[model samples]
Target: MRNLQGWEIFVLLAVVVLLFGAKRLPDTARGLGRSLRIFKAETKGLREDDAKDATKDTTVTTAAAEPVVVEPRPIESGVAQAPAAGAHAVHRDAADR
Candidate 1:
């Protein structure tokens, strides 16, 4: 597509002025500018937050570079293991009698 010529730009501005009126045009433009500024600021903040998150992820990965090996601890005397199914039935019958 070809670029907009000066005449096209002028016509578009004239149409906008006619549609919105001269009085409301400045207020509309100001509101549009404010919206753009707020949008830019939010996007910039999001980019900064994303950068921080990226650094955090990198540091976390590097810090845990070596694979961690965790050995299971032996069961203590105070903690009892569950009995076998057959043993449970026998125990239940013995208790009932």
Candidate 2:
């Protein structure tokens, strides 16, 4: 779009004044300014967060990671027993009732 001339800008402002009235113009402008300021701050915070994430993504760790070893605990019983599915369903139904 072409840049508006001074007269066009003046006419636009005059139209706005006519539409919203002179009394409400300052309040409207103040609200618009506050919204823009808040929007700017949020965008700046997002950019900083993205920059931090980008840096974190590019970093190389020199330390060699150790492999995890998990030891299993022995059961008290010599044989392992699995519960029946029907028994579980029956227990749940009884509890619900």
Candidate 3:
């Protein structure tokens, strides 16, 4: 296979424009750009989530090594009680990264 040059790309685009009409070309281009942007955002979000998950797995192993069973505190009136500070705090620490 051969690499396409600038002129070749220009000619290809011109042919596409002629086939699709000048008015529809802008709309098609805009749609293509939006699709690309969405794809990039989704891919980046997945990568970050995977990294965060890997960190959590490592932290889980760390927590497993430390023998602890923290309990929940009593809630005041309408507020919900948070988990006790020992092992629960470690999970939060891993996720924050």
Candidate 4:
């Protein structure tokens, strides 16, 4: 719980300048700023996407809670019913081949 004094700030800046020369400091700061901005934007987008997905899930759950009624199809006697579209059917009769 200690606040940095002016001397500490000056010393930290001096060390940073020594580590990465004065010429490269501006470029480094700019790159750091850009990286932080990009990270913030990506995190914001992810939060928004999560919020949208949560809403969609809630809506889907509410809709699913309602009962659905399905009508039964009539079948004809003595007739082989064709399978529905996109369904695989196996023929049991060898004579029909």
Best candidate (score: lDDT): 3
Better of 1 and 3 by TM-score: 1
Most accurate candidate by TM-score: 4
Question: In model 3, which residue pairs have backbone atoms overlapping below 3 Å?
Answer: none
Model 4 TM-score (2 dp) = 0.58
Candidate 2, which ten residues in sequence have the lowest lDDT sum? 86-95
List per-prediction Cα lDDT, in the order shown: 0.76, 0.77, 0.79, 0.78
The 10 consecutive residues of candidate 3 with the worst lDDT sum are: 59-68
Per-residue accuracy of model 3 over 1-97 as CA lDDT, tens digit each: 9999999999999999899999999899999999999999999999999998877745333333443456556678988766554635334344454
Distance from true position, residue 56, model 3, in Å?
0.3
lDDT head-to-head 1 vs 4, winner:
4
Query: lDDT per residue, candidate 2, 6-61, as tens digits?
Result: 99999999999999999999999999999999999999999999998987867666
List residue ranges in candidate 4 displaced over 4 A.
57-97
- How does model 3 fare in lDDT? 0.79
Worst 10-residue lDDT window, candidate 4: 59-68
Models 1 onward score TM values of: 0.57, 0.55, 0.52, 0.58
Tens-digit per-residue lDDT, 1-97, candidate 1: 9999999999999999999999999999999999999999999999999998877745333232333344444557879766534442222333343
lDDT head-to-head 3 vs 4, winner: 3
lDDT of 2: 0.77
Candidate ordering by lDDT (highest first): 3, 4, 2, 1
